[model samples]
Target: MSLKVLSALDVARIQLYHFKAIIIAGMGLFTDAYDLFCIPPIIKLIGRIYYVEEKQYRTTPTVVVSALVAIALLGTVVGQLVFGRLGDRIGRRSVYGLSLGIMVLSSIACGFSICRTRNCVLVSLGFFRFLLGVGIGGDYPLSATIMSEFANKKTRGAFIAAVFSMQGFGILVSSVVTMVVCKIFEATSHVSNGQIPEQVDIAWRLILMVGAIPAAMTYYWRMMMPETARYTALVEQNVLQAAMDMEKVLDIPMSQIAEDSLLPSYPPPSYPLLSKRFFRRHGYDLFSCAASWFLVDVVFYSSNLFQSQTYHRFIKDQPDVNAYELAFRVARFQAILAICSTIPGYWVTVYFIDRIGRVKIQMIGFFFMAMVYFAIGIPYKYFWSEKIGIGFITLYALTFFFCNFGPNTTTFIVPAELFPARFRSTCHGISGAVGKVGAIIGTVGFLWASRIPNNNGKPDPVRMTVALVFLGVVCLVGLAVTYFFTRETMGRSLEDNENDDE
Candidate 1:
């Protein structure tokens, strides 16, 4: 038999048929990015509305912030198992629609929350974040499967990943939105007794409301896209009803199928996850996937979340700036570079995903990021930039670009590729959940590091260097893991799994 390998141009043409799926799938992603970007601004709002004397407050404790973010991740962990299992049993079509609905309802609910007490806010915040996580988690399986299953074999890696690269759009749009809303609030902000509570309702709540729109719009699309042919084929074997159901999904006649297309009927609605020999074969791959995701989360979230500090470390010494202005500048500047990093990185990934191969591009990105990380940390620690502070800022910005284009993107896409259909959602969720575990560690570590000031009464360069160096090491470790375990998936289709028995 001859081997089949697809080149880059072939990926572009094949992905065109399912372009609608790519657009709709990005809806949940936009919301995920929206929620993440909205948080820091909201954190600023919450601080102002509920400020204490400097002695009484320690900046929304990292533990608190981590819990809020991780809670959403926690929701995703549970969601993947529930919806993933359900998606397998009930069919991907209905479950995909239902997950988006949950996200919409929960996000709208969050818009109305009263964040008066810290606990009340944390609890309510956790609740909505969890709801959002569940929906985002649910999307992983459906989107990954759709992109992988439909694309022509030649460009499977690039095509499926390009679909996922829309996440950069989600994240990019969110950062921009936050900056816009912040400007709006600042312009219209009414301050009473040195506080900005009135502005919170208009700015932050409005941002939360933004999350609901994408879900509502995409509900219609998910209703229309053609279901996977593999799924239709999976059901055709048993009763005539199964094939009939697929006929409705594919809009194709049952008589047209090569009789061999159908799978034999199973005993019932489902089987134990472990019962299939397929699951047993997948054990090591699944473990690698989980490990890869966990490491990716650690490096990505840690690096991304701490960008607020890169601004501080770069400009902490300017003598003339007032505290509030410095704070605004910090938030604003980070938002801009982050957007720079986010938008182009996404577009580039979409452009090169097929050409470079997912694993190769990710490794390249991490390699570049590690270099930038050490460059910034080591230089700043030993030789701080006084004249051109922007030089250090430039290094930080480069890191963000790589983060958007590299491991961050790859980690999200890989699990989607590596798993079989039945366990894809579950494993993706597990992998994602594991990644959140890294987020928690990174968040907590940075929070603590921020508290450790040097003898000069500034954030210790040694401490910042240590944190970034540690992150670079984690990225290197992730690189080794990918090299050993992941097969190059550049020209493979998701349906390749159907031939496992061979």
Candidate 2:
């Protein structure tokens, strides 16, 4: 009976409800990207506001910057483990709205973080952002699993990719928002002797607050979404309700689904995650997904979070620019990069993911990522020159392109498809949690490794070259894992992917 009910979902035609599911789930990811990526452009502004030294604004202490950025990532690891398990234990719908609720509240709180002392303000912002990260973390497994379970097998990859693609838009929008806010402030405020204007403080707060809008808008729709037919039938053992839910969503007759629920029921497999049978079947796939996600994020987040520092290295030295001007320049560059490379890469994946299969796309993406990183790193000084900076930026943009088109999309897609319904959310959560660990490594490790105080607080040429080489090596490792460990899940049903029906 469970197989029959699931088959109905697997073979169903793409419909309006499918698109609805994509938007409802996709918006959470949009908010996730906005909240996560938006901070990099504003970190300097925050430092200027609070971390003043001898009446001169100092570069935010490396430790303080890492904590500000990495605290949320740390919270993400915890959220993924806890909320991921809860998603499987409770119904997806029951806890779905709760995560969004946390996001809405926390985003607002982060913007309003104000205290008497610098430490108090920093701690308050970090605390709220941690809660924001928790909410963002919950969305990963929940959104990916829900979209995978709701989609037809033929377009499952595309559907899930579509949901993930919202991330690109979120990133682009954050850049745009930061750029626009900076431009607004730049016109009204003036800097003298390099001191930041008071209005700069308000700008960062507004930018943080804006992330709440989309998440808040989608909360009602997310609450209205029904539990996936697979979870309802396979996990909840509720064939009749599953059938009824499908009948409504698929706009099919009750007659079509009613016949399946009446069929004889069979018990589902009850192996725990630790059993040898479980390891024998899924251990390598989990390793591949986790490792690939881990590796990709280490490179991706390091580059993404500190892109401003990277840009400053290549641009002509401007002796007269203020903090707002510096931020505007960085945000503008990032927005352009997103438009030219990042956003397009995601849509291209959406277009080809179902057609080419996930494994090929991932391997191809990892391969090109390595090639591009090497291209930039090998002739480090040649590309670093101000005259040829465009060449370096082009190569840098390609990494973002291939990442979104490659492992970034597939890692999220494959984990949801590779596991059984009972463990789908849990496994994907573990995978995503591991990925966040990689993000923390990237954010903290690369920030420390790349910054050299001896180089007037700029990234040292040798260290930057080494960092690029390391990322390239990580990509090569990802490519090997994709080839050896992951399986293709293009046209297979979830049960078929896991051999669950047998």
Candidate 3:
């Protein structure tokens, strides 16, 4: 049990438990993505249901749309900071199930957000969405830290990225589920004179409620998971418990070393978090992770939450289509984009992350994202024109492709690996929280920036051009920060990365 001796968990080959960790941690992200992305397709439906004026439903106000989408992001910021520190202080396994519980309850509450007035409904829905966001936020750091701790160094990047890649499937499933629900309602509901049927309300509710299912299903498994060995040994100074946990999970026989015998070998107490000594060690690493995540999310969440608005112009002005049909079309388009670009980008990152290294992959992702954004922005009007609209869509999808393959995956993985065990979860939480703040900016800023004053709620091409250009600049900044400040974490044990021997 000497500190220099390789732990059984570190040397362990790929096994069933590693995959189990991925599934358990990954499912939380899947639920997070499904709940967050599902709202875009249904936002119009919510407006139609609650925002009726003069006995006819109209588009929901821009302000309301922003609130509905951004509230959860705001809550996510709170959750990440809170649960992240808690993970370090209380233990990763202790409060893990609590976050999922919040998600389940809040999702169900959001679905049943029925009230006497539109204001009441909005209040209720927004409140629950914020709570759900908190739960989703908690998943970010905990899942990454747990997976990184459990994985062997040889494939750590892939394992951590695998947990994050579930987000792609979550987004894809949201679109697919939305499409199926819209189709079901379209087929069964009566559509007299092509008016949106009342049953459409039920469809939106069903979509919101479905997010609860996956989260609830995984809660038992999350609770059953053991505290990561790194936290037990390094932070808690309980080598005996750490060895036992590793032995159980790795299914290997661990030497029964006395706790006190190994205590002297543990790394001496390090600088306190955010102290001068701590900053000297990790300040630049932290800044890079936080800034990169923030910038990526600014573009990422904006595109995701409002892509329907931007792409709605290309749906071939079907003036006669009913609301159900419109919903189905939007969901179908999103699904195609997810399958073609988003999901593939994620799995590709999973395959190559360990081979190419974290810093390089992130830089590649940011560099290309900047180029694509500028390409689309500089010729914004041309891309949106009738003859070349497909080109615009193609370029838009590519942004997502590179994003998943690049910063989106790397940002999550590196934070977990770059810091000491004591501060790993907290640092990841801070990085993710900063990213959520950027998400808030993107969701609110893009919606308002792209809205045309008198274009009946349509996105303005000129304003969208400006937004895209701004995002391109942000990506360039991310690339610069990553290249100069981010350290490579590939092929290194977590202990090695932190220089524990020092």
Candidate 4:
């Protein structure tokens, strides 16, 4: 009958709780990024162990190798949808720890990817990684929704972006870890030529198993987190409990918030996403988030995950070299680029997201990404040339910077803020799921397209060029949608956005 009152959390000054929430939530993403990107290098290592060793000169088929890499995205897609809905229905904290536990167990299993044959080993690895993906996917909606709900409106964008920025560190760490492990193997293995043979199989396993340590470390902390006050108050309609939870989280006195007579009563919502009421309000928001995320991921995952393959393709025709040498080169390039460009771009978003607005950053990021991709595509031969390859590499690195500074960061931030508290996790999950689908498309499609045969049945640079151009077009389209349809949520309370839906 009356307006609902804001709690200490909704309008509270930025404080310690916000940073703790960011670190806890961000750590999940850090683990997610590490697990997801770690697979790419291992994919190369596996190929060397099986295909190249057996055939003496041949690599694995593109489709087979792509499946090994992209299967986790499929798992993540299903995980986001399932866990996201469960978080909304049951509660965020109830389902949150379970996801991390799944990740811990699955990461350990992924390390033990052994079987009687190469095909069997690949299958086992894919299966365990899919299970690991299920955990990583759940973290997306849970972490974003948790951070958004826990944060004050004034710094909410930067807080959420800060959590997502952990992804850059995850990626950087994965690369550094891979390089370190490779170097260690080279030192320890008795090979005189500095080649790490099957002895380095231990490296991939160690890398994957190490991912479990971080997830395990965070389990107690995630479980200790109180359910978000927003969900408790809005969806559960328990203002007293919500107030009590906020009091604990914010260290505020409860006597001030205990008066229930002033709080408005909310009937439970029954708005299905397809219903007219829901469609009229959030349909465009959902469409925009899902579509823009979809486009960004296709390029992001394809480029990041298969970076090694891109390098390998350039040298495919050169004189034969040991696979370990090739893997080292790929890891070194990826690590340097991630450290220099990718990680910084993410923090740039964190530093300015609340200040510049999310949609604007996304637009600028998409525009520059398109320009960079096109720059590489049109001069494909020139950039690929030994004389100017460094320039091309620089441009390629810029795409990573733009991706972090652009749609990749904003898409994750906006969905968590745009939806009603009742459906926040669900909508974020939907958008994240769509993005993973884009990742699958990018990974599979790019791998297939890059290998399309010419009249001579060799790797076609022209086809690869077309793929790069397509990435540029996708970014332009996303940029348009973002500029036209995406609403900015800067400096606004979550309740403000929720009230708009009513």
Q: What are the per-residue Cα lDDT tens digits for candidate 3 across 62-105?
A: 77778887999999999999999999989999989988888898
Candidate 1, 400: how far from true, in Å? 2.7
TM-scores of the models, in the given order? 0.83, 0.94, 0.95, 0.93
lDDT values for all models: 0.64, 0.83, 0.83, 0.81
Model 2: per-residue lDDT, tens digit, 1-502?
3366677777888899999888899988898889877876677677667767786665566677778778998878887877788888897788889988998999999988976367887899999989988998898889999999999899999999999999988988888888888888887786563766778888888999998998899999998888988888778877788888888778767766665335436466877874887877788778888998999989888877657656766433253467777677667777788899989999999999989999999999999999988887777745563234677778888999999999999999999999888888888999999998999999877777665644365566677778888889999999998899888999999987875543
Give the Cα-based TM-score of candidate 2 against the true structure: 0.94
TM-score of 3: 0.95
Candidate 1 regions exceeding 4 Å error are: 1-17, 54-59, 189-197, 235-280, 313-331, 384-388, 454-458, 497-499
The positional error of residue 347 in candidate 1, measured at the CA in angstroms, is 2.5
Question: Looking at candidate 2, what is the lDDT of residue 237?
Answer: 77
Candidate 2, residue 346: the lDDT equals: 92
Report lDDT (Cα) of residue 89, candidate 2.
88
User: Whose lDDT is higher: candidate 1's or candidate 3's?
Assistant: 3
Superposed Cα deviation of residue 49, candidate 3 (Å): 2.1
lDDT of 4 by residue, 122-219 (tens): 89988998998899999999999999998878888999999999998888788778878777776667554424367767777887888788779888
